[model samples]
Target chain A: MSTDPTANFSGDIAGDILTTALDWKNAGKGVALATVVTTWGSAPRPVGSQLAVDDEGKFIGSVSGGCIEGAVVTEALDAIADGKPRLLDFGVSDAQAWEVGLACGGKIQVYVERLDS
Target chain B: MKREILEQLQADRADKRPVVLATFLKTGEQRLLYLVGKKGLKDLDPRIGEAARAALIEDKPRTLDTEQGPLFLNVFNPPLRLILVGAVHIAQALVPMAQLAGYEVIVIDPRSAFGSVERFPGITLSNDWPDEAMAQLRPDLRTALVTLTHDPKIDDPALIAGLKSDVFYIGALGSKKTHASRLERLTAEGFGPDDFARIHGPVGLSIGAKSPAEISISILAQMTAALRQPAATPASSSAAA
Candidate 1:
């Protein structure tokens, strides 16, 4: 629900997120894009926040303010490998949230999909 | 997303066109919605079109639960623009501040002496008269205009153009008596009180700002308020006399 459309993600603008994904894809690397589709409570990153990942597990941008990016990157790597899209839901109540450290009492659903070659 | 769509989206943004990417969650299919002259996309579901219009207006992305399943509307709006009608000292201070706040700053002043590149480096400068410049700029919903020149020969025409456009904010720098005289002049030009109300006369919030830089801050703060809180009563109207 952030009003600012140009909100910074890891000091990168929204355009840069997609541009990076395009660049990685153009470089012949497997690429996946994760977007926060919905959120509840105090989600650090608002819905539409995006994170781009490559097959090497390198990531740009953020989905949860460094709280659950690691988990998202892992999911993105899987999506890239399988060329399959998946929706992931993370909440404070889930033990997986504790493992990935999304302990901010917020819930977010992230959609991870690979960039079609 | 397909590479062609990604490339198209990047080019649309580069051209400052407002667009929405409607992603169907179940199939990963996306429909790129380009707004056609303030109208909803043709042949689109009225419900989804209405939601996209709302998302563009609010400049926020959203998820809509439609009968077709969940769809995510990712809004891509052009960057905000700030057009300063005078390359005064305050304009010098305001340019960097506005850019930092995510606005593309442009200074318009026919006086080359004041609008010189040396005075405002790396900033867009226009030597054309205010009216002509505003005509070319076509101030829109995302544009904010400030008249810093104390000369009616310059500020007046700009104010007239700004009042006619849908610019989010219009601020003029002057005193109460000066603004009163300005209103009289504009009134003679067929502008009504409703139009006058749009101009933040005696510009900026009542911060008692003395320095040029402080005044710039007050003006930017007022612009931010007008942009972020359109429903709130303007604080400068009481001092607009």
Candidate 2:
């Protein structure tokens, strides 16, 4: 357990993840945030996970799905369309990723977009 | 929705409201440590001293390697979340598990018989279709969604809608055979076969789970794994495309 004094994990990641995003959003900068909302069988994660990305192909945070991130990054690019927030998803509600990633363990969905100022 | 809460946390940070973010990282021993703060970010950790300050107090994202393994520094300015799509018997099991995992869970279901405050006590309850009720709840990168409804009428449309949005983990309950049938139907409705393959059919791993409640445990366990680690393997869709 990292009980480091003066270290705040809550504010840093949350801040680092959103600070630039919100700044870009406020400055009318193009930014996208993709998050994991659900999962299915054999997945390595739970729901309520996230991954943040930008139009330039820069990224922070994890859509958290291991290898499928490349695909999710593609979705983040789509979110940059017209600079509006949009949703993106990968995997099935109950099916598994056989060839692409892992099988019966993915089924992840994400929301992407240029942060609303 | 998990995003709403995360948004609130963001607002709290912008306003410098009191908040804390805790993540269970797999470190040298996979220890459970919470990063607590609301701007001051000091005096939060009891182990704080002048020597270990550099490791703990740094003005950047961190990755700490402990005796167990690598400790992933997950930020949570406003705490954690819990987004539930169904209010069923299995949910009864998941809600507690989520809360135990340090999440604030909110459940949604349209059926009154299934979604009742009486049944799900001490948790946020919303009686609405999973798809329609999404707007009411907000989910973010830090948020996760767990759909336990086995009924396609409730699960499918909601899932399709979720598929198009930014919510993590769209889990549904069904067997491999049931999933195959569902996949055929989805393909008939224009969903690509590759797309259909994303679903975690049978809902949970083949841990030999039988009942709904037991399935819920298996499913939640899987969800926890998804959160704790990176997606197991990378997909090769480009090869197919």
Most accurate candidate by TM-score = 1
Model 1 C-alpha lDDT per residue in residues A12-116, reported as the tens digit of each score: 234488888998999999999999888999888888888999999998888999999999999999999888888899998888987888878899999999998
Candidate closest to the true structure, highest lDDT: 1
Which runs of model 1 end up more than 4 angstroms from their true locations? A1-5, A8-15, B35-40, B135-138, B160-165, B175-197, B207-210, B233-238
Tens digits of per-residue lDDT, candidate 2, A1-44, equal: 12222223342344566665665555654567665434454455
lDDT of 1: 0.84
Clashes within 3 Å, all models in order: 0, 61
DockQ of predicted model 1: 0.44
Give the Cα-based TM-score of candidate 1 against the true structure. Answer: 0.84
Per-residue lDDT for B55-140 in model 1, tens only?
87667788888777888998877778999999999998899999988888999999999999999999889999999999998777
Error of 2 at B90 (Å): 1.1
| Model 2 error, position B195 (Å) | 4.1
> What are the interface RMSDs of all the models?
3.4, 11.8
Which numbered prediction scores highest in DockQ against the true structure?
A: 1
Q: Write the per-residue lDDT of candidate 2 for residues B28-64, one digit (tens) a residue.
A: 1111232333233343344322212332222222344
Off by over 4 Å in 2: A2-117, B1-60, B63-79, B188-190, B193-197, B211-213, B233-241
